[model samples]
Target: MKIVVAGATGSLGTQVVEAVRAAGHEPVSISRETGVDLISGVGLTEALRGASAIIDASATSSTSTKASIEFFTTVTRNLLAAERAAGVPHHVAISIIGAAKVNANYYAGKAAQEEILRAEPDGWSLLRTTQFHEFARQLVGHGKLGPFQGVPQMRSQPVAATEVAAELVAIASGDPRGIEPELAGPQEEKMSDLVRRYLAATGQRRPVIELSIPGAWGRGMRDGSLLPKAGTRRGRQTFDEWLATQSR
Candidate 1:
């Protein structure tokens, strides 16, 4: 089977591409490096020419709500439109856990993507997962304010991106089943603590300050909203473990 992986150059997308190969399927990668502009719809139809399924693992780095929403919605619309023209059967999307409840800058965009996918009467699977173990690394200096860094007041159960990729590949291999069970890490850890520990492991001496965000988004972060719910799938690697490996 030929699987087209959108955002093939991203962190999770790269792993998804590898998982596709490991699963004994051909992966057609779509990214700027490969001449495909997801938002612009350039090279999309041709990319999906012979694909059995297309996994949208793409993401945007913009923190602006408008930009994030535009990027996700545009990309999703373009992919679905091209898939219809190319006769691609399955459209697999990766989303964040509690995206609907949390209208935070980035989560709002994810929720918008989910809304679009749910309306489409095609073969599509939406996988919602918590933050990845690498998320802490990504947020190390996220709120850097001179000598003290501000960590968001949140709790996260982060799974390994590798595990998420394998699960997504497995889902794309079979028929679409709508939304799948949420996937998360083995345990929950405070985001501030995780960032602090990460800094220490990397031998970077910086004071970590927890920022109390306001509004529903902040509530969602501080509360258990970001944590995985009952029956949510779990992964083995702990944040400490991922950090330890990084320090080595």
Candidate 2:
């Protein structure tokens, strides 16, 4: 089977591409590096040519609700249109768990993406997963305030990206199951603690300040809205286990 991985150069998209290749399929990468502009639809038709399926792992880092919504909406519409034109039967999208329940800007965009995919004329499959274990590292990188790092006081089940990628590939290899089971880590964890541990592992001596953001989004984070529900599939790697490997 020939699989086209949208945003193939991204964090999760790279893993999906490798997973598809490991599954003995031809993995076609679509990204800016590959000359594919998902939002503008430039080079999309050419990139998707001869593709059997499309796994949309493309995403934006914008936290603005409007920007995020526009990004997902445009990209999804372009991909679906291209899929229809190319006669691609399977369209798999990677989404976030509890995106609908959360009030964050990014979640709003993800929720919009889900709505769009659900109504897709060509049909689609959606996989909702929790934050990746790398979330801690990302926070450290992005949440810096001078010499101190601010970590959100939130609960999370951080799954391994590789595990999520394997599941996505397995889904794409088979038939489309609209909204597959959610994937999460083995146990619940505190986002602040994860950040502290990450800093320690990297030998960074910055003070870690735990922040309790006040809002529905903050409440959802501190609460368990982002956690996986019952009957959801769990990954094997815990944050501690994943952290151990990261220290190498």
Candidate 3:
């Protein structure tokens, strides 16, 4: 089987590509590096040719609601159009847990992506997962404010990207199951605690300030909307376990 992995160079996409190959499938890499512009449809049709399935892990860094919505809508539209043209059978999408429940800009985009997938006339599957263990490190970088590092007051069960990748490959190889079971980490952890642990492991001495972001998005994060529901699949690696493997 041949699988087309959009955003193949991304954090999750890279693992998805390797997992597809490990499962005895050829993974066609699609990214700017691979000459595939998903939003513009450039190189996309050629990449999808002869492909059995497409795993869309593509993403953007924009935090603006309008920009995020436009980016996802365009990317998903192009991918689906190419898939339709190529006669591709399955389209597997990775989305964040509680995307529909939150009012954040990024989550709005994700929700739009899922909605588009749902309306596709072809076979598609949506896998919603919680935050990755890497979120802690991302917070460390984004939360910096002079000498004090800000940690949002939220709760999350952060799964490993590798684990999520493996599950995505398995889905792409099998029949499409619309809205599959959610995936989460082994246990829940506070956002501030995760950041603190990450900083400590890296020998950073900056003061960690816990902040309460205002709005529905913030409420959802602090009120357990981001946590996985019961019976959801849980990843094996805990935050501490994953943190131990990171380079100092």
Candidate 4:
């Protein structure tokens, strides 16, 4: 089977591409880097041609609700339209866990994307998963003001990106399952502890402070809206296990 991967250059997208190849499937990639503009729907149909499935690992870095929403909503609609024109049967997409329950920042866009997919649910398979293990490293990228860096106080069951990618590939190859069982890491960990552990693993010296994010979304984050629920698919890699794999 030939798989078309949208946002093929991203963190998760790149892993998905690797997963597809490992599965012995040919991959057609679509991204700005691949000369396909997802926002404007330019070059999508052509790229999607002869593809059995297109996995939308499309993402945006914007924290603004407006920008995030615009990017996800527009890109999702475009992908679905292109899939229809190209005669692709399955569209697999990833969304944040509890995105529908917490419409804040990036999750806002994901929630909107879910609504669009729901319109024709039979054609798409939606898998909601917790944040990736790399998310802890993402927090470390924030430069400290003095001796300590502030991270949002939250709990996460962070799965490995590779595992998520493998699941997406499997989902794309099968018939759309509507909403699949959510995926999560084996253990729940604190944001601050993860960041501190990340710093220690990489030989960086920085104290981490757990700061309370303001507003309803912040409340949601701190309140465990993003935690894995019962019967969710659990990934085997723990945060410590993934950390050990990183280069020193």
Per-candidate local distance difference test: 0.89, 0.88, 0.90, 0.90
Clashing pairs in 4: none
TM-score of 3: 0.94
**lDDT at position 144, candidate 2:** 93
Which consecutive 10 residues in model 1 have the weakest lDDT in total?
134-143
State every prediction's TM-score relative to the real structure: 0.94, 0.95, 0.94, 0.95
RMSD of each: 1.5, 1.4, 1.5, 1.5
Give me the overall lDDT of model 3. 0.90
Worst 10 residues of 3 by lDDT: 99-108
**lDDT per residue as tens, model 4, 1-248:** 99999989987999999999999999988889999999988788889989999999988878678999999999998888889999999999999998889998878999999989988848899999999998888777763758888888898889999999999999998999898889999998898899899999999888788888888667878999999998888999999999999997
- TM-score of predicted model 1? 0.94
Clash count per candidate: 0, 0, 0, 0
The list of candidate 2 runs beyond 4 A from truth reads: none
| Candidate 3 per-residue C-alpha lDDT over 83-115 given as tens digits, one digit per residue, 9 for 90 to 100 | 889999899999999988894777888888888
Consecutive 10-residue window with the lowest summed lDDT within model 4: 137-146
Winner by TM-score between candidate 3 and candidate 2: 2
Better of 1 and 4 by lDDT: 4
| Model 1 alpha-carbon miss at residue 90, Å | 0.5
Local error of candidate 3 at 118, Å? 1.5
